[model samples]
Target: MKILLTAINSKFVHSNLAVRYLKAFTKDMDYDCKIREFSINDREEKILEEIIKESPNVVAFSTYIWNIEMIKRLSNLIKLVDENIEILYGGPEVSYDSQNILRELNGDYIIEGEGEKTYREFVEYKLQERSLEDIRGLYYKKDNNIFFNGKRPLMNMNEVVFPYEEDENLDNKIVYYESSRGCPFNCSYCLSSTIHGVRFLDIERVKKELSYFIKKEVRLVKFVDRTFNCNHKFTMAIWEFLINQDTKTQFHFEISADLLKDAELELLRKAPKDRFQFEVGVQTTNDEVLNRINRFVNFSDIKEKVDELLKLRNIKQHLDLIAGLPGEDYNSFKRSFNDVYSIKPEEIQLGFLKLLRGASIREEAVAYGMKFSPYPPYEILKTKDLSYEELLKLKKVEEMVDKYYNSQKFNNIINYLVKQFDNPFDFYYELGKYFDKKGYFNRNIGNSEYYKVFLDFNMEILKGDKDILNELLRFDYLNFNKKRGIPDFIGRSIKRGEEEEIKNMLRHKYSFKEYYLESFEIDIQTFLKDSIIIKKKDYYLFGYGGDIIHITEEIKEY
Candidate 1:
């Protein structure tokens, strides 16, 4: 019997660790098993064609919130082509409501919860013509009645197979590895909280797996652990191992900042720059909101740890906040935004709350007056504290944040604006309001247009000093890209002869041998327009990629 395990990923770069794990665990089973993966962006017809070509007797799909609708459609199409084809569904999206999924979607079977051992057993039962009633975690339809054999016990971590050994071509794609399963904290909104306890693989096993990835120099190995730093000793051991390896492979982890011990922080500080990235979920700053969601975090301690982390300037920190939640109104959310923004993380992920199935928050939605989209993500439209109108406003704010703040294109400009404005939220709110009023948010806007819009906002709305804004914009623009051509709105150009003179001076000052002149290479006209020429006591030369070199006056010791 042929069995095909598949997964529809959110992106092409994301490899489905779940499907790979399932495939690896069932390798030795008495059946033909193959793993196929496709992205949500892929056309349905193309995906259907590929699946039909496989012509497997059984097709099991790993489902998630992002690709459930697509998988359902694909499953229906597969059944239409061949009625004998058995369709099975698994993963978190269908794990909780297998019965409903089987009834509504007409799926042939679902292996709920931990599927490694259960799937092998089910496949063996089917191949050997054995009774299906004995298989645990198997929800199958027999004689027009659905039978749910109770959930299987969680498998030991050591028994779980290593998925990557068989897969080739690991370069560029994100390699997701899990050292542990489940979470320690019972955050009401999170699906990870559904699993009661945490289980870990042996440290030696984890180290061996990590060594392979490090040796291969994979682009990124993002830990799929619910809370990576839940166990301080385990986390430190892994961190120390990675640090010692000093490989090009960068590791990413979702960790609780507040839980970081002093020694752990010190160890992290010692690690190489840009070698690790930590995604800290500070969902909301309001203690009341946090408490309502059963998310216990010491905001002050988290801030303290994050501040300490920032001082090192090595590890990339991505802080997150959820917009609509119980007890968090528009004003309260603004405070949360400003509070997190103040810490100045590498990226501030402004996300909306999704009422996921089996999550405690979804059950309490009615009590909180939560109205959500009746779709896959089930994102909140409104709640008791925040209205639909207010949520829409936040949506606009999210757009602005994504375009400017999160893009890291306007780094210096954002820093300057925050200092000029009362708070970061006001800056973003005003910018979002301006974008909405001008109808900029309705369609696609390019990077150049974004710069123009910011300039317009600064000049027209804020009525800031033109010279200072221009200087700040110049600094911000050059930090990211090479000097190609300066926009007319920002500055004016110099004469051809004068431009030639400045270029010659720059060339003489920064020899091709001493400085990396290739990156600093610019046409005379482009250099004249883009370079900021400022008079500070004496005439100084400033190129886009280099520091100001004293041209007229001798350099003085500080």
Candidate 2:
């Protein structure tokens, strides 16, 4: 059998790892696998023509909320060209309402839960000319009838193949794998329910996967698991293995700080700094808001664990908060913000509550009198508890988070001066509010305008607070928006710091080859030396098309 695994990613930058998993799962199976990825950049007609030409025995689509509508359109178009081609849809987006999705997408077969065994079963049945509706993990629509054998008892992951063990060298690719599935916490506006429940993949198998990347010299491995810290034993085992290996390859995991045990913290502390990054969804600290959304939070413990981790100075900890959530009015949101802000994470990702499809909260949104956009994301416009005007105010605050908080360019300045207020949210909120009134922060700026705004904003931040002026001088260029000549040039090695911001300013002004000579590392000496000019010396520079050096920050101050 021939299979076409297509993934239409939500964005250009993100690679579609599902197809890689499909290819790995079907490696030994009797089939010809062709992996094709499409994005907003790809021409639609060209992709459609290719699909029409290569009418394979099976067509699999990995679904997500962002690409569902597009997937439906593509599936319809594919059916128009070849109706007999077997279409199967899986992934979180369709895992919840398999029957409806099967009918709607005109899919002959749908795999719920893990795709390895279920997808293999799909191919085997088709190859042997057997009825697929009887497959344990499959939901199928045939003879104008829908059949579901219910979900397969989630795969014994040990029996499964490694997600990237095939003919292709994945060293160049930013590989993603899950040590576990399902989230333990059931935050109301979350898709944890849709995934059914948590089942950890084999740790040894996960290590083997990591081992491959180590041997292959892949620089980064991003764990797609939700709440990586949920399973203490599993988390420890994986972290212990990678730490012991001492490979240059780094691993990124999203964890729940509240659930992180002391032992887990110790294990994490042992890992090489900058090699591991954790994103904790500290949605809100307001107890009422948390309870309204069915979230169980140990605020005190969460604070201590996060702060301790921040003190580690090795790992990058990104803490998150949601602006629009149930029981969170303007004042309540500010309290939540300030509470989270007090911890002072390396990065604060200000996000809005996206009342996603198949989420528990969306079901009871009416009870909360929530007015939300009727879309895949279904973001809350406002709830009875929170007015629309206040939500709009929160939007401005979110903009501030993106610019100063999340972008992290203003970290030095923020840390230096934002100390007078007890509530950090009030401090940030007031800052964002002040900027909007000044007409300094605009959505229309491009290149030169961007720096003008950045510098101007930083200068304003310094005038009222002189303590932050020196902090502003230690700029990391990478924190600003940047585009390079080569996509995936540095991949995960690049951090949003001065190096990147400097690189961006150069590339936008010149070209890559113009500044790039030898490979460069951004150190303090190089940063200050590069501040002056050096010609005739051919060496790698820090920024794109610039000279290279790595000097510590203290030297510049001295």
Candidate 3:
């Protein structure tokens, strides 16, 4: 019999680790098995045609919240083509309530949790004509009645086979690796909280697998571990190994900043710059809100640790904040935003709350007056403390944050502008309001247009000393883009004589060969037109495509 394990990812760059694991574990099985992956962006008809062409005896889908709806439709279409083919579903989205999913989706089988061992057993039983009544973690239908055989126990991490050692091609895809399974902390809003205890792979085995990835020099290896640094020793071991390797591969981890020990911090301090990126979930800074959600964290301590990490300047830090949470009104969330913003993280991801299927937040949602969409993702619309109108305002704030702050385009100007307001939140809130009024959020604007909007807003706010704002805007605009002409709103053109002088200076002092100017792909004439010259008592400098060139030294002063 032929078997096919498939997944519909949210993006094409994402690879399905679940199907790879299943394929690796059943490598020695008699049946022919293969893994096929597709993105939600693919056309439904194309996906259905591809599955029909495979003509497999069994088709198992790895389900997730992002792709559940798409999978249901695709599976129904597959059944229409060939009713004899068996259909199966697995993954966290369907694992919690297998019976309901089985009844609603009308699938032949559902593997609840820990699918490797149980799926191998089910395949064997089906191909060999053995009874599957005793198979744990298998949910099936018999005589139009659904039956669930209960969940399987979590497997020892060491028993799982390495999935990537045999694969050759991983171009333009993020390779996922997991040194451990399960999460130790119980954060109510997260699905990982439902699972208790942590299981780790043998250190030697993990090293061997990592060695394969390092040897291949994969572009990125993202750890899927729920909390990568839960075990200090395990984290240190992997970090030490990766740090010493001679490769360009970068690794990413989701860690708890407050839990980092002194040794781990010191080790990270010595690691190479840009080699690692850490994602810390700050969620919220409000203590009352944190308590209500049963999330254990010391906001002050997190800030201190994050500040230290920022000082290192080697690792990229991504701090996250959830906009809608229990007891977190707009005012309280503003405080959370300001607090996290002060840390100067490389990226501050402002996200909203999602009521996951099995998460505790969904279970207690009614008490907090949480209303959400009845579809996948189940994003919160409003709550008792925050109205739909208030949430709409925050949504605008999120858009502006993504455009200005997260884009890292106007870094220096944003820092300067925030100081003019009472706080960072006030600046973002006012900017969000302006963006909404002007309908900027409804349209897609380019980088240069964004700078124009910033300049206009600053002109209104500063009222006086417009030159300083213009100078700062010029600096920021040039710094972000390398091959773009200056926007007209920034300044007027240089005088005819000054323009001629600038052209002579560029040819005589900063020749194309001497300064490697050819690398910028800009001609001297275009550079002269776009350049902003700054004349000082001792030196004459100009900004062109983020470069500050001093031309006075080459000229003889009278």
Candidate 4:
């Protein structure tokens, strides 16, 4: 039997490890398997034609909320091309309630939980033309009877193969990996509902993966586990491997700061600069609101510990704040926002609650007067303190935060101009209101409209000249990030430098043009190695000159 395991990802940076896992641990000697990947840009007709030519007996497709609609449409097209082909669905979006989805979409079977062992067993049975009703963790129908094989047991993670063995070059800027299977916390608004228990993959196996990534000089490893620090022993061993990896690779983890111990904090603080980034979900600072959401984080401990980590100046902090929750009224939210703001994190990520399909909260949303969009995201309409109008205003606020606050471009400008704000969110809110009132968010307003409106807004607020307006605009567009603050953009962070010196092959800091030209004897390739970014316009420089002075135009590479 020939089986093609397919996973459609958003981009090359995204590798569906679950599909890789399914391929790695098939445990079937009677079948041959091929792994195929598809992205949004890939030609669907060509792909289907190619698959039809191969004539695989079975095709297993991984599903996720983001890719379901596209997958369904493609599945329909595939069925048209080859009606005899067997189709199976697995992964996050393949509801445990697959009876409904299968009835509507006409898939052969839908597998729930871990697919490795069950997938192999089902494949073996199929090879011998055996009955499908006995396959556990899958849903299938025959005539008027429907059967759901009982849930499949979890796989022995340690015995699984490293999915990247076939990936010739692991030289991506951002690659994701999982060290665990489930989340420990029962955050109501999360997909941890279906798989409520936590299970760890082998530490030695994880260390080997780290070695593989480090050998290829992978710049970033985004740990997709919900709470990396949930299992301290497993987490610490992984951290130790990362610390001693003898490579300049950076790692990112979404850890629960409230649960981190002193030793974890110490190890994190001691890590190399630009080597680690931690994204902490502070959801809300209001104790009652936190309790109402069935989230178990201690806001006080989160603030204290995360603040300590931020002070290390090594581990970059990305703090999150959710806009809509059960009891967080606008005022109460203001307090929560201000409370977290007091720590001055590197990045303040503001997101509205997404009512996911399998979250515990969605089941109870009706009781809390929550109205959500009936789509993949299922975003909340409004929760008690956050009214519809207020949420609309907050939506605009989200735009401003993405544009100004989170971008860190409005840092010095806001500090210099915003006097009435009690916290950073206040500054963002006021700016959002300004942009909304000026019709800046209108689709009809083009780039020129945006420049004009923002130019006017800045001048009025800053009481400054064209230079300051240009600076504010430049701050937003340039690749030179203050990363954590406003002192720099892509340009040099020189203050009060009124004199210019005649320079040759000038190295204007982050400018890619100069670096590319070997202005600093920097192998624009080796100096950057795999960590380099290819963007449009200027790389990250204010100005560079050999004889004539020229500014970078725009980013265009990647």
Question: Evaluated with TM-score, which candidate comes out highest?
Answer: 1
Clashing pairs in 1: none
lDDT of 3 by residue, 121-153 (tens): 888887885578888999998899898777788
TM-score of each: 0.91, 0.78, 0.90, 0.81
Cα lDDT tens digits, model 4, 144-227, are 566787877777667666666645565663677878878887778877745778878888888878788888888788888889
Off by over 4 Å in 1: 490-558
Encode model 1's per-residue lDDT on 464-557: one tens digit a residue. Answer: 7665556556545655655566566655333457545555656745653332221121122232354343433222344555544434332232
Error of 2 at 93 (Å): 1.5
In order, the Cα lDDT scores of the candidates are: 0.81, 0.69, 0.81, 0.69
Ranking of all candidate structures by their TM-score, best first: 1, 3, 4, 2
| Total clashes for model 1 | 0
Model 4, residue 542: C-alpha shift (Å): 5.7
- Displacement of residue 28 (Cα, Å) in model 4 is 6.1
Q: By how many angstroms RMSD does model 3 differ from the true structure?
A: 4.8
